[model samples]
Target: MTGRSDEYPAAPKAARRNRGFEAASRLLRERIRTAGESRGFAVSRLLTHWPEVVGEEIARMSRPVKVGYGRNGFGATLTLLVEGAAAPIVDMSREQIRAKVNACYGYNAISRVVLTQTAATGFEDGQAVFLHSPKPKPAPSPEVQAAARATAEGCADDTLRQALERLAENVLARSAARAAQKKG
Candidate 1:
């Protein structure tokens, strides 16, 4: 038998090297890119960073649907899915939207912006979910907080008491607001 062992060939240096954990986004990037390409999106950044590309107000009312490239592939038309009621508002800001989208690509890639209005519930695919940021609730009045604390005073557990106090505060504050609204 020869001095060299041929039973098991040595593994490649790269394979032997320890590869630590990778980010989920890095692993799924290729899959995301492939899916985006199928929808005529050359770069997935436009879809992923829609909110950042356009302002929060515009993003809340609309979402990017797809990009359509012409036969020559010189200029592409970007289609935005907008809320039915916000169609006119979005249409008015078409130029601004187009400019922002073009700037995102670092070139005037988008020739025009098209808005497609959808019903209140949005499309069949359920892609358009109009999410509005919840307004911060005002702090409960001192009287309301005291009343809430008094209600939770009977609880022995510190954590449970604190939770009950918060619940009472919210309930009392909401009722107070309703009463004030009726008076106004």
Candidate 2:
């Protein structure tokens, strides 16, 4: 037993091979649930689907912040961070937003929307929260470049041909880098 790798039981293997790695969204959900005290989870979902739940016009102007649960443990009030001067329009559309959000949840989840207005252009602020750094992709290795040229040789359009060549190079380089990371 002392010499065995299985001397102590490791965490259980998934029942089916190659099928049990959790999606990144699942981890995000668990974090949201734990941090939100239940109310936050729905709020996060609303934020994620905001563009779909509310129309683009409203979504661009407002963002769901916190959910205040009533004594009934249902019929919650949603607090939204909004752009300045747009609160009136956003407030006016609350009923429509609520309908769309409830439709997203497949039932009634938000009873009212509370707006807190900030800058007139909320786009930059909202984008910062979700965007990763915009670092440019590195140049591909010589092997990848050759492969890309070979792959694009059949393309007829000069512009399309160049675009396909670049895509091939990027894809190959990205895959190679990922493999290297796994190996390391």
Candidate 3:
């Protein structure tokens, strides 16, 4: 038939075009994966060995603050948030923190380190610095648990939350089945 003959030509061209696209896509994916690993390594090295680089600089400061990742036009920035109204809160400005972070990183990648004052109580309460020991225990509550899980999700911090979410779904399904049986 005429239809069969026409389909034959289009089929070969479609197969060839698909194959060409797949090859190009595979190459681009490989390149992106390699570049991601390189950039990830750079960020990890900076964070992992941060104390050695910034420990002295932080020590010199009277005000105690917590350091965490920040963001702006640049990819990942560092932030210094003051924790308390303690006497040692020497009122260092954002610019000072930025300068210190830049010097520590040995790169201008950090656009800035913004300073924010938090109303939370200070290290004077004898809570050890988080870097030095295990994190303090939080009181158990459903709201607290949900918030912790959601925060973990937003941070892209770990796989544990995903595992927990999966487990929670199973538990919920089991409970629903039990309720249905009871109603029946």
Which prediction has the highest TM-score against the true structure? 1
Name the runs in model 1 displaced over 4 angstroms: 1-19, 120-184
Sorting all predicted structures by lDDT, with the top scorer first, yields 1, 2, 3
lDDT of 2 by residue, 1-184 (tens): 5688868779887687676788888768777666665545454656677788788998888877777878878687877887767899998998988888778768887788788777534444654243577888677899999999999999999999999999999899989999999999
Instruction: Give the Å shift of residue 105 in candidate 3.
Output: 3.3
User: TM-score per candidate, in order?
Assistant: 0.58, 0.49, 0.28
Which residue pairs clash within candidate 2?
Answer: none
Per-residue lDDT tens digits of candidate 1, residues 1-184? 5666786687777645366787899999999999999988887998899999999999999998889999998999999888889999999999999999998999999998999888536476766665798898889999999999999999999999999999999999999999999999
lDDT of 2: 0.79
Q: Judging by lDDT, tell me the better candidate of 1 and 3.
A: 1
Tens-digit lDDT track for model 3 on 11-91? 444434544455664667656555534543233433434455455455334332333334434534444445555324434
CA RMSD of each candidate after superposition: 9.6, 15.0, 16.4
lDDT of 3 at 100: 56
In angstroms, the error of model 2 at 147 is 54
Candidate lDDT values, in order:
0.90, 0.79, 0.49
Candidate with maximal lDDT: 1
Clashing pairs in 1: none
Q: Number of backbone collisions per candidate, in order?
A: 0, 0, 0
